[model samples]
Target: MACQDSDTARLIDVELDESVGRGTPDVEHERAVAIFDLVEENSFRPVGDSGEGPYKLKLSLVEARLVFAISRENGEAVVTHILSLTPFRRIVKDYFLICESYYDAIRSATPSQIEAIDMGRRGLHNEGSQTLMDRLKDKIDVDFDTARRLFTLVCVLHWRG
Candidate 1:
């Protein structure tokens, strides 16, 4: 999808709330990579003239709600969107289960079995990505890949292990 100037429409930095407990080493690695990828290349535009581009985002979960604290590159206040987590509950739960299965499969299952499990995991991830995009459509405009990375961050917030 077309976006503003590549430098301006992208995320310059991404942070997760400190209150969100850390997960297992593997999960932590995944979170780190997701943030890195998001900051490297993403198309994020806050709906309306909330602020100029090159935004910084802090993802947090508060009272069962997903909080998107966005700001300008210079630390100027932009917009904070609190979205209901209800729409993502099922997808997140299923994704976690599939991820567990895929990880376990990697250790002993056949290559084909592992591949199958991974496919399922990706399917669920895509579903979650779409759900996130749909939910944020009125708040922020994000492409599919951006939504995928954001979904990963959201899952990171939900991670308990």
Candidate 2:
């Protein structure tokens, strides 16, 4: 993945909206938020360090910290990643799992959902695109397409310091 600065991308900050079409749904968005917060507090470890869930990110400014996790709901893997900067990045930004479970099942997702998820992942510096999504894919060692779909369910949680 390549790393490039993105001036066009805007970090998403809406409170979880379900998809409108044929893609994964957004039923677990709220639980994902809670889970992300929990993982951030108790499971901050560098990637490849061991175990699973609550994996640490590989890139960041010295003063910043990035973390991630994976949650399985109805067999779908929701990948979550968080970025924290002590000085603050003007405003706290959050990227949520675009794909989630609901109605005891997943929701009907859309291309827009994929775009939303992709937007949140812009400017990542990994072997594929430096997006946290790509990193998660590599760490999990899954196929690119599946890794992507799995990552949308990945959530991000935050606390101001």
Using TM-score, give the best candidate's number. 1
**For model 2, how does the per-residue alpha-carbon lDDT over 61-99 read when each residue is reduced to its tens digit?**
223544434433222334455544332222223221212
| lDDT score, candidate 1, position 149 | 88
Residue 30's C-alpha lDDT in candidate 2?
Answer: 41
Q: Tens digit of lDDT per residue, candidate 1, span 20-137?
A: 6688997798889889988887999888854578899988778889888989999887899999999999999999999999999999999999999999999999999999999998
Model 2 poorest 10 in a row by lDDT: 3-12
Listed in order, each prediction's TM-score against the native is 0.91, 0.22
Indicate which candidate wins on lDDT: 1
Least lDDT summed over 10 consecutive residues: which range in candidate 1?
1-10
Report lDDT (Cα) of residue 63, candidate 1.
84
